[model samples]
Target: MPLKHRFRTDAALGLVQVSPPLIYALVMLAAPLGTIVLFSFWTQDFLTIDRSFTLNNYREAVTDPLYSELLFRSLRIAGAVTAATVLLAFPIAYFVSFQVRPARKSLWLFLITIPFWTSYLIRVFLWRVILAYDGPVNGTLISLGIIDEPLSWILYNANAVVITLAHAFAPFAILPIFVSLEKIDRSLLEAARDLGESRTATFFRVTLPLAMPGVLAAILIVFIPTIGDYVTPRLVGGSGGTMIANMIQTQFMRLNNAPMGATLAVIAMLSVTLISLVLVLATRRWTRSR
Candidate 1:
């Protein structure tokens, strides 16, 4: 049967629009994921990957304390980034959406995304330079007499990782929030005002509730990718700042343990997915309660 005869015009149009991306995803994403699943169950020796199946990789991944620490560290750092990104982005998003004249909103939003125009690696290194012992931060502090000497604690640690990731993901967090805020109905604020609510109260009561979806989107966008970021941690995250992705990279490249790496990848993916599901459910509950 012809597609048009089998489905209505709108349905056919929807399918047509979706099919290209779906096929591309299947080829690019699904195929690699399926391969990783297979590799996760197999064993690898010093040089050769064993075709035989085994549960040892999964066992080792769970039983090892180092993996857990790195996983937890990644989660904690990613969570901090998510919170910081959302908090910082919200004000800018709110200003652009509600306060800025419509004519210049696009320009302001374009400025938000200007960071992405630079190479990501360059940005990471730029942070390193800014936070280095004798760098601008220390130089400024010394000039202002805030400190007598350069601080050695700024660049190479978890704090640095969180700061860099939060900065890197800020635009992502902001755009979604801006989109959400822009979608809020103007009449909702009018309704709140007519009820004798103050400006702050109206925002808290009406605007926030309506903007939760965008906030949630911003959180997920920042949280999910930052947790697995290898480059940021590798560059600025000294000994104590390594995340789960760093270990996975070690397993795959340094140790020549593809199976273990694949297993770790799977575990990290599942863990992130589980946390995201819980967060989504909790947000839904909270919104419903409100």
Candidate 2:
């Protein structure tokens, strides 16, 4: 074959290989998202979609006190969970990446992931037992003379929801942070140390900035899912812990408002997407500057 013909053939084959993934993305992801976007704007009559575009849903979602309250609550709780996860996961990831041998690091990673093999519902329910008024936590506290009576505030509240979600998401934070920490060149830390930097200064100047990408990724992973979580809130949130997701559920199943439910979902999705984008841009800028 002539050189020009060979180049054309290779380009054609490349296009053919790429087409499958593009088609799959359109069908699996784009199609469902398109439907959600349409449904967000469509009006509904007693659970039936009327196929009429209206701003009524958005108006209600943004203006109504009930939904607005739920949205703010969800945002606050998700924010707290994100902050807690980052603070807690960073040290574990640092230790695993920098301190442990490679073989033992793999073992620790395996241990972190192994718990996920069990049913998530079961694991969450287990927390209920542990956090209950008459549970081991209270029992141990009483035995240790920390409290005379069982703490009623320990279960079925916002605190419970945050704790449960944080535990669930800790591994997500750890893995990304660990990967980023591991990828950092050891020479960077050594150079900082050789410059007469103390351990704390070296960590702040050399380690933390390099690990920010992983921290950003972990925040995105935890915050997005925790914001949309229905099971944890319903299981342990009680009245105070009711998130926007619970409101969406009520709209769909009990109130028979599919359009409104979908609208809330879309709004939540857009919020998460915006946050993720901001983090990505910030991380890119930080990486480039560093």
Candidate 3:
């Protein structure tokens, strides 16, 4: 066969391999995104939608102080949850990666993943029960005489939202960090220690740098999804805990303003994309520098 013909055949084969995933994305992901973008520029009222193009939705979604405030608040909450999840997951991941007996590692990992077997809504409600006035947390504290009354602060608040979300996202943070930690070459740590480095120094200089990619992955996975989590905020977040997703929900459902809701969704999605890009770039540079 001529060289050009061979190259064309290979290219066609590559396209064939990619076509299924490309078509799946086009149908499932791209279609919904396109619809949202279209709706965002339109108008809606009383179960009626005007497909006519306009920037009014974007104008209100952006210029409205309420939308901006909620967007920032959502970012903050998502940031906090990301930090907490990564910090808490790191040690457990480290323990599993470096300390667990090889035979027991699977068991430990499986146990950690057990929470995923339950429905997400069920887990949220379980947190509600645990944090309720008469729940185990307050009851235990009161029985131990640690507090005079059931603490009202634990349930239906921003802190509750954070705690619940962090717990819910713990496994996501763990699995990635564990994969990263597990991939580190053990010989590198040994080499660092041979140069008279303390265990702590070796870990900081060798292990942590190698594991940073996983840490970044964990951050993006947890932060992005949690930022747009309407259910958690609605269930656990009282007025003080309402995130941008809750606002979007109110706009779409309660207000029957689909255009504004789609606009808000687009804004939220763009914010997450921007933040994730920054994180990836920053972490990539940091990893290379190390």
Candidate 4:
């Protein structure tokens, strides 16, 4: 074959190799997102889309107190969950990465991930059972004489939502932190110790700083998903724990208001996107500064 023809043939083969994934990305992700963006702007009648561009839905979502309250509540719950998960996961991750024997660490990691093998809905409902009046938690509390009556308050509240989400996302928080901690050079810690730093000081000055990347990753993983999650909050959060995603579901399903639902979704999406971007930038700066 001529050199020019050979180059063209190789180029064609390369394009063929890349074509499937490129097409799949366009179809699966870009196409749906494009449609959603279109839907956010387009108004719909009860059963039909009018297709005219209007900002009425956006206006209603922004101006409505109910929507704003739900949005804020979602943020608060997700933030609490994220914080709790990170706090609880950090020490566990530190131990697993730094202290554990390599042979035993894999088993520990597997145990941590066991819950994830079950269905998410199943896990949420399991919490409902665990926290119910006759459930294990209330029973234990009552047996311990902590309270005369079973606390119904514990079963369906924002606190429950936070706790459940934190539990659910704990492994996510742990894995990232473990990865980050594992990446740290042991020589650095030895250097800190040789310099006469105490254990606490060594952790703060050496280990924690190095682990910040994983901490930030865990935050992003937990915060972003938990903020948008409607499932756990809906199951356990009764009235006060209702989040923005639940509201979105009601709009689309119960109310049959697609435009309004899309508007809320887009708003929430924007909020999450902006917050995530800020966090990622801050984390990058923290990493760079160290």
- Output the lDDT of residue 189, model 2: 91
Question: Considering only N, C-alpha and C atoms within 3 Å, which residue pairs clash in candidate 1?
Answer: none
lDDT of 3 at 74: 93
Residue lDDT tens for model 1, 131-183 = 88889999999999999999877778998999999999999999999999999
* Per-residue lDDT of candidate 2, residues 1-290 (tens digit): 88667757878779878999999999999998888788888877785679977989999889889888898899999999999988999999999898899879889999989869988898789989999999999999999999999998868999889888898889999999999999899998999999999999989878988888788889999998899999999998899999999999998899888889999999999888887898789887986786
Residue 48's lDDT within candidate 4 is: 87
For candidate 3, the 10 contiguous residues with the lowest summed lDDT are 3-12
**All models, RMSD in angstroms:** 1.8, 2.3, 1.9, 2.3
Candidate 2 wrong stretches, greater than 4 Å: 1-11, 284-290
Residue pairs with backbone overlap in model 4: none
Q: Candidate 3, residue 75: CA error in Å?
A: 0.9
Residue lDDT tens for model 3, 1-290: 88667757978779878999999999999999999999999899789898898998888878989899899989998999999999999999999999999999999999999999999999999998899989999999999999999999878888899999999999999999999999999999999989899999988888998999899999999999998998988898888889999988888889999889999999999999999999999988988888
For each candidate, how many residue pairs have backbone atoms clashing (under 3 Å)? 0, 0, 0, 0
